[model samples]
Target: MIHTDVTEPQDFLVALGGNMPSEAGAPGDTLQAALAALAEAGADIRAVSAFYATPCFPAGAGPDYVNAAARIGAAMTPEAFLALLHRIEARFGRERVRRWGQRTLDLDLVACGDAVLPDADTFAAWRDLDPAAQMERAPETLVLPHPRLQDRAFVLVPLNDVAPEWRHPVLGRTVSEMLDALPAKSRAEVLRLP
Candidate 1:
């Protein structure tokens, strides 16, 4: 297991996503409340991307999703921070019924200050896993700089808004660069939420 030395108040990138309604209201409103919850939970929110409307990943799994990204400073270990995110999801009534299923809120820890949890080799293997394999299983451990980030326009596009220069620890590509590398259609699918 590999671990990076973490400094106090490390920066973290969190991906926000949801398609279902909750006590907090619509998906976009739920995301806004989630951000506020993060701040209440001791996350010093540095930046947040504008909300984007993205089609459901499975092409009909559920309603369109509201997606965004936020940069935050936190004084907690990666694992602990992830736990906090999960707790917030639970608060918003998220369920783990199916992979990539609809949800009221989904907060994914995208990156933590260039910190590579577990190890680089494991991260690479997961990052390169075939799409079919991805559908069959999820990573057992957290993968920093999120393994599939570069391939998802929903993530990269919103990340570009807040952290255009944030470099992927392993890929070494900036968010804007990754966003530009995506096919035009993938980019076009992420429309700003009105």
Candidate 2:
């Protein structure tokens, strides 16, 4: 029988990270398995960045993290895509024990084309939150382009690998530009995993 895929595909930027071991083994191995699971769940795997070894946020909270980025083409709403990401994380033994706490897997929906998941004002407020205020809380829902995407080296460095030119719909800066804008030390902290 002749069949054609009818789902409307949209570009998606997903950030993957973890510091703890899982059923798949090491953090890096777990991430690889997560990618395969994403593909199996119907994300059209377009490109993936090399993994990077990054110091944990908050400096000395836990073990170092293995981080990476993936560019996907998928036919799903941003909310649906985010839900799928959560499901994948759950499959990999992810647990939300604490904010910024280490885990077995983290699949973050960094961006979904130029579409904003909630609205412009909420997105802007979260994106522009003061560092001190940010530590006090987390968004209750998915935030597109990730609220802190511009400030995180671990996310930006690997993102530059597969989608250096992808612009932040709200910030209007390319991934490469965002990576360059980070403080020298922050940028230096992300070492490519060999």
Candidate 3:
């Protein structure tokens, strides 16, 4: 049940990532479950990117990841939305055992409304980094213009596939623009999710 007295409808960005399920769960399963969970939490998904499998950063000892990005309209603050995401992750059996380790679910509130995160706390650190740093150290903050929105082809490509017209409030760039800005090497591994 969602409490809706505190906010109005606004767009949100959610990114998903996780390695092959071991004792956790399947990537696809987690992604879909997250979608349903988000909907249940009061956000209506407006667009969803096709799943993209990519190697985890920092070269971890994990399997290839299945990732996606979603655009949603909800009546919740960024903080509330993030809290709900963690709850959904916990329901899917995710545990903080390893940094960038495999998991059954990983729903990240990559952006919220039109507000840029301005803090550097555990819940808001990435709010101040550039695009590359945000991608390199995600799960740190759900800041927007998604500090790394313009650099990670993994995110840009999927986001373009889903919402080409989506624009960054702070940078004044569209999803296509962001994708166009990624380095060639960063854009290499992404493909159209079927």
For TM-score, the strongest prediction is 1
**lDDT of each residue in 1-194, candidate 2, tens digit only:** 10214367878899999999999999999999999998888788999999999999878889999999999988777777778889889999999878888899999989988877688899998988998788678999887879889989999999999999998888899999999999999999999978
The positional error of residue 120 in candidate 3, measured at the CA in angstroms, is: 11
Total clashes, candidate 2?
0
What lDDT tens digits, residue by residue, belong to model 3 across residues 1-194? 76654657767788887775633357876788778888887778899888887777546677777889998887777777777788888887889776556777777666775577754253244545565554455454355555556667767877787778777766778888878887877787765556
Cα lDDT of model 1 by residue, 6-104, tens digit: 557888999999999999999999999999998887678999999999999979999999999999888888888888899899999999999899999
Clashes of 3: 2
Error of 1 at 62 (Å): 0.8
Stretches off by above 4 angstroms in model 2 are 1-6
Better by TM-score, candidate 2 or 1 = 1
RMSD of each: 3.4, 2.8, 3.8
For model 3, name the residue pairs that clash: 131-147, 131-148
